[model samples]
Target: MSHRMERVNQLIREELSRIMQREIRDPRLEFLSINAVETAADLGFAKVFVSHLVTSENKKEILQTLTGAAGYFRGELGKVLTLRHVPELAFYWDDSIERGARLNRLIEEANRDSVNPSGE
Candidate 1:
């Protein structure tokens, strides 16, 4: 995790977010959020973590859709960045936000139970 790699990852994340907002027309990607980006030091491959506020019932399908659009993202990257070698894009579902929300709900439930032990 050198400084250069970190900068590259951040640039990728920002560009992906911009592409999703201004370029993509897919309905399935309307709510998608580019959570994070991780690229190899050699700039050969990248993993883009995507998250959404919507339900995860069809999470697989959503990721598959994004994977299908990887080529488009890569092309856009090539147009935007001046790097000699652009990383291959790979989409992954990031469940961190969902997990954090669930954890918060559980904590709230525990607090409620503690305050109302009588269960009225």
Candidate 2:
């Protein structure tokens, strides 16, 4: 990312954090963290990635809820952060945490197999 894009992404993250905490009345928005933001080169759109601390059960419903509130979130972002263009905001669930957990489990299983090669 360019320096300007990085700066803008940081500002968006901060402003969204504030909005999520103070402005959003939706209970579905709770227990979530704004993980990252990707702004298009033309600044016409932004993809907001979020991570939820809650269980993966019903993860699809959670993502649906967040996406449904995209317009409200974009409005909040525009209100809090003054920018030439507040790009259309899109929400996505960041799966990095889940990927990391899966990788760790695989590594652990490999290590255990190496330690006890013979079948018990």
Candidate 3:
């Protein structure tokens, strides 16, 4: 991506994060954070990755809620941005944080087993 593309991606991420925090009042979205945004080269489409402080159980519902809210989000984003065309938004759940936590726990368990070797 060129410098312009990178800047556009960052702008979309920041603006989306702000919209979720302030504009939306849904409880399901309260814990959501826009983790990153990937805009296409032509800037006609974007993938918005989101992370939540909430638990895994709520993930699906949160995504559905965001998906339903995409149009509204894009409209607000378009109004705020100076771009001639606002990219279509696609929301995706970013599970990297949760996956990392699970990996850490597994590593710790493995180390503990190596040290003990038997139930004590």
Q: Model 2 over residues 72-107: C-alpha lDDT tens digits? A: 878888887778888988888898998999999999
User: How do the residues 1-120 of candidate 3 rate in per-residue lDDT, one tens digit apiece?
Assistant: 799999999999998888888778898888787888999998899999988887768888888998898899899989999999999998888989999999999999999999999955
Worst 10 residues of 2 by lDDT: 53-62
Tell me the deviation in Å of residue 84 in model 2.
0.9
Error of 3 at 17 (Å): 0.9
Worst 10 residues of 3 by lDDT: 51-60
- Return the clash pairs for model 2, or none: none
TM-score per model over all chains: 0.92, 0.87, 0.90
Checking candidate 1 for backbone clashes, the offending pairs are: none
Error of 1 at 89 (Å): 1.0
Cα error of candidate 2 at position 19, Å: 1.4
TM-score of 3: 0.90
Give the number of the best model, judged by lDDT.
1
Query: Where is model 3 more than 4 Å wrong at Cα?
Result: none
What local lDDT score does residue 32 receive in model 3, on the 0 to 100 scale?
A: 82
| Candidate 1, poorest ten consecutive residues by summed lDDT | 50-59
The per-residue C-alpha lDDT of model 1 at residue 65 equals 90
Give me the runs in candidate 1 sitting further than 4 Å from their true place.
Answer: none
